[model samples]
Target: MTRFPSQTPHGEISEVFSDVFFVTGSVDMMPGFRISRSMTILRDGDILTLISPVRLSEAGLKGLDVLGRVENIVKLGSYHLGAHNGLDNPFYVDRYGAKLWALAGMEHKGGLSTDHILKAGGDMPTRDLSLFVYESSKMPEAMFVLNREDGVVIAADSLQNWSEVDEFFSEAAANAMTKGGFIRPANIGPEWKRHCAPAPAEFEKVSKLPFRHLLPSHGTPLLNTAKTDLVQTFSHQFS
Candidate 1:
């Protein structure tokens, strides 16, 4: 299994404002293997609620800057808050960001410092957006829930990425991810399990969605039975 390097290319892809219009970009892997990163922009006129911004270049930053007023930004997970430290933007971190806020200190990228701390009601105002907070830890990993009527779930590191994580990692890294509480073999670890656990209950919450598609932060967006495959894979590991 060949490992693919990170290829988000740093830019704005698409956005969804409150008016029911959606815009996004495609993230890809090497050659035929590619994927797209997502940044949700929920807007009410000049007010923009940005999801996670990618590693954009100078020009890409210009494009992202041109997109909207971008008042408040939200980071959905620990890893999702990647290397854009110098970005002097206001950020709101739900439970996930609060858990990983210390990381912003290590590298000078991502949600450096901003107004508004993350709290429970974060999802209520963003009702048009989908919200999935899987209990990955006491800190919890943030999973983006698409507020679309379709009900798709946009997962960051929780679902990681197939192409981003090679089959080799799935085999060898399983032990490490298992111990680190990110993933497990066949079944999942109690630490990062969904809806904070018991598996079945997590399955129930996921099943309630009318959507079958998955938009992951890395690799590719999955459709068809990929959703079921991922669920079953995680379920099998539940102990």
Candidate 2:
């Protein structure tokens, strides 16, 4: 049997909105360097979907069970599997027989593979959600727009709102990230911009989405004001 990454220190999953939950966790970047990351969970009746999943503790698994069965695992970022300790998708798939979803061009590193290919206009895990793809990015990067409570945007690397350094970040990692200009509120992911170089028009289309909340893979949830709060970021990056 292939051994997958073990569960690391992560906070308990907590409800951020109606049926949306998030868990803050740490990613091992290198030997002793670690940084914060997050996973978004969505519930529709008894079916649960995990987006940009983080390996959880035994207790966390039990908590997840109480909510519903893990039926779907969604990957919204092309580079998500590259995080050293963030490779937990197969664990869920093997354990619960869950289906994995990702964009067509996303790299399946470390023997990771997807069960479904998500597109800009195609089937989604749920009916109330719609997909948006970054057509200009070198790698496949996408976002989910949930059509509920006005609107909610779920993203991986395209958007972020770190707010502040949290427990998941080691001291050295935190300092380095701050210097790298990643510890900001309502900002485009610095590294994603440098690597992906998505077209400005792509974000312009995102800005027009009806989303009011943002559940990012690497930052705190920006509720209600997700769209308004990112006004300057969109302008600065695009303009």
Candidate 3:
């Protein structure tokens, strides 16, 4: 089986913060839609933690080598585990309770397993990084917070920022996503709510967190005023 749908000649790695970088790749989800998968790299000293990993090409691997040695692989939820095939990483981690519920389904679907289960307030491989369980969504999802001078929240699938469809998107898919409320900037994922049945109170609690940058797996990163944007975007759902 193909590890990835397609590989870019060079992984498009962009620095989000001092020691944080992101790579974007394509995923074959909808026929006409150009769905994207993002991999977030958090570098601590000479060690790196890969979150929601995507398969990279030879040049991409070279790009990653410039960063640091990859020490750990993390899947924020079950839905983000598709591209983790054949990775010989040292450590792997998943959501705390996902093994109890998602492991069977993942095994049946030929997905990989985690070496460690992560929980909120638990220790991560990297220092100054913390995990939080998004209790609002029924699906087992975890969000990471980088406690730096400027706080950053690394989100999985719940919060998206698909401002506009890119060149990879088919016209039909773009239209469908826009109409389905999936292509908005800094908004809750429509399909996630439909499938996971999230509660607004959970997001209300999230809105109160002091995060300035929002790095989502699906869309562009909100560099500034991310908390305010999140509150304004989904506050109505809370009420």
Candidate 4:
């Protein structure tokens, strides 16, 4: 039952029913776009997978109080970990961003618990969890899938959410998915296509999952046909 702001180390929770939920926090990254992101609240029996950490401001955290004692906090990638509040679970990451996550901690506080590598095969969410980590065509991108009954799949930088982007980007540059926010193949999302390079094999592995929808950290989530769009997005990414 802890709370964070949309731009600070705060969180907000909203259940979309059927155990599928959404939690968002506000943030103040830098120049433009005062962002507000939500983490998909997923629960598989006892294991809770918080999708993405939303930026939370001090006042924002005070407003949207969230309650969820997550058994684990699974970070999608290194840059994505900025949303991490203070959960003491085993930190996990795909290949590309683990070192950065670790360095960020070392340079700032001290360090984090050893991070688990999200490799193929072991990357699948399995047993109703349906977790899938694609070594994206962009960076060391990692995504999640929780199955039909579970009703949620947390997409990291793979989905370019224009709806949300419009709010962040000025009216002139809204569709700048390739510029800033999530998975921007063109030049969006602020993430360069380097460092932890994308692994096509990884994306293929995740492409064959049965997810009902996708909930991304940046932009708007692919609510209904998230699985399809997710697969297509990656397909075109490598194609």
Candidate 5:
């Protein structure tokens, strides 16, 4: 019985803003084809909420313990529900006795262990976080806006900022993603866009959200210029 998909290589947790931390990791898409992904952790007092989780090493877990207790594990996107790569929602739930908050329609994916259903205007992990659902996407997808630190967005697969292929990306994956248009800056997720086909109006509304920075699950964090950069993408994507 695999306690979790053999722990993959991931970076140490980094405090991007106050108690908001970020970590980078890789997901083996196939043999010799691994791509980079990320996770965001938010701490409010002694409680911590993990969004788009990635399994960490034993030392990394100790570092996480130093931050706070893992109280809530949130899954914002319906597509990546531990189905591919290392989402690690169930492992954290079993290990920490944490609640899993997942999108309403994702249960069919199996193995989700959904303790709470995530929906617009429903219960959130923290008061400072607000949910923004893509109401028209083929699959359930959403983002969170942290009310503090000039507003930081915690995104899943919809928004991305993969400016370049970093070390986490295997050369095979890098070349493949680059050809598929997955390697770009401040861009809509090419795979998500092609599969989900979310309506243009969804992004139109996203551009208006009061967020300055975006910490996406699939790319480098877009700081300060997130809104400005995304607005450009929306103009091109939705105009």
Candidate 6:
């Protein structure tokens, strides 16, 4: 078993909406820069469901304990399931990669694997949560909709909203991301488009979803006017 790197301390948890919380962490993506990573926590009744969870320290867990018991852990897409810390609950993922897990090597490091495979338009066990799979991308990705206040769309790498490069980025990484169109607010991630090659029609369908808040794994959350912003962003990229 490959020993994973120790969990680094992510910043304080901030509320994104009434029942949604977000935490920012750092990931070594670009050679010299530590890219920003966002994780979403949703409160349902007395249970707390984590979406694309980053490794939280003991203090972080205690902070989360105040919200509710961490009952369900979900990986929205193939790329964001690396922080599973041996929780016995079933881990969820879309059924796009059966033969080969996209990031199995990383999964091994975290001792986590997907046990529950969600399908497009399928119902997740969690109440008021629905999953939609994106078929056009070369890599299988899914976007989840939470029917909380004003509705929220929890996405993975498929959708990003980097208003500006955060301080975590090195100058080189910031410049490259800015030139590649990944630093703009309410825009598609450049790396996602270049690597996933998502189809325009798929985005067109996503644009129709009834969501007002966009909580993504890679960037800032758009609290209001999320639908309009996403439609315009998709139109600019696909139209």
What lDDT score goes with residue 109 in model 3? 28
TM-score of each: 0.53, 0.95, 0.82, 0.60, 0.95, 0.82
CA shift at 81, candidate 6, in angstroms?
A: 9.8
User: Which residue runs does candidate 2 get wrong by more than 4 Å?
Assistant: 81-86
TM-score for candidate 1, residues paired by index: 0.53
Ranking by lDDT: 2, 5, 6, 3, 4, 1
Model 2 agreement with the true structure over 42-99: per-residue lDDT tens digits: 9999899999888788899999999999999998987652554237877888789888
Q: C-alpha displacement of 60 in model 1, angstroms?
A: 0.9
Q: Choose 2 or 6, whichever is better by lDDT.
A: 2
Model 6, range 33-94, lDDT digits (tens) per residue?
A: 56677788888887777777676666976888798766566666654422332221222211
Task: Give the runs in model 3 whose Cα sits over 4 Å from its true position.
Answer: 1-11, 30-32, 80-111
RMSD of each: 9.1, 1.6, 5.0, 7.2, 1.7, 5.6
C-alpha RMSD (angstroms) for model 3:
5.0
**Model 5 has how many clashing residue pairs?**
0
The Cα local distance difference test for each model comes to 0.44, 0.85, 0.66, 0.46, 0.84, 0.68
Which tens-of-lDDT digit does each residue in 1-239 have in candidate 5?
18566677888799898889999988887799888889999998989999988889889999999999999988888765235722577678778988888778665322656788877778898778888999888888889999887899888888999999988988889999999998889999887888889989888899889899999999889999999999998898777
Q: For candidate 3, which ten residues in a row score worst on lDDT?
A: 95-104
Query: Model 4: residues >4 Å from true position, as ranges?
Result: 1-12, 31-33, 44-49, 55-68, 81-110, 115-127, 135-141, 164-195
Give the per-residue lDDT digits (tens) of candidate 3, residues 1-239.
Answer: 25324543224899988888987765555455456557788898877778766667767777787898776766666444234322322113221122221211222222445556677766576778777676655667767888885788887777777787765556777777789887888888777777777777778778767678888877778888788888888866555
Q: List, residue by residue over 1-239, the lDDT tens digit for candidate 1.
A: 01322324433354332332222333432344333444445555555555554434456545555655544555555534233322222222321132222211123244255344344336333455545655433334555556454555655445643433333232444444445554322223233344334435665565565666565544345555545766776556553
Collision pairs in model 3 = none
Model 6: pairs clashing at backbone N, Cα or C within 3 Å: none
Candidate with the larger lDDT of 1 and 6:
6
lDDT of 5 at 157: 87
- The positional error of residue 103 in candidate 4, measured at the CA in angstroms, is 14
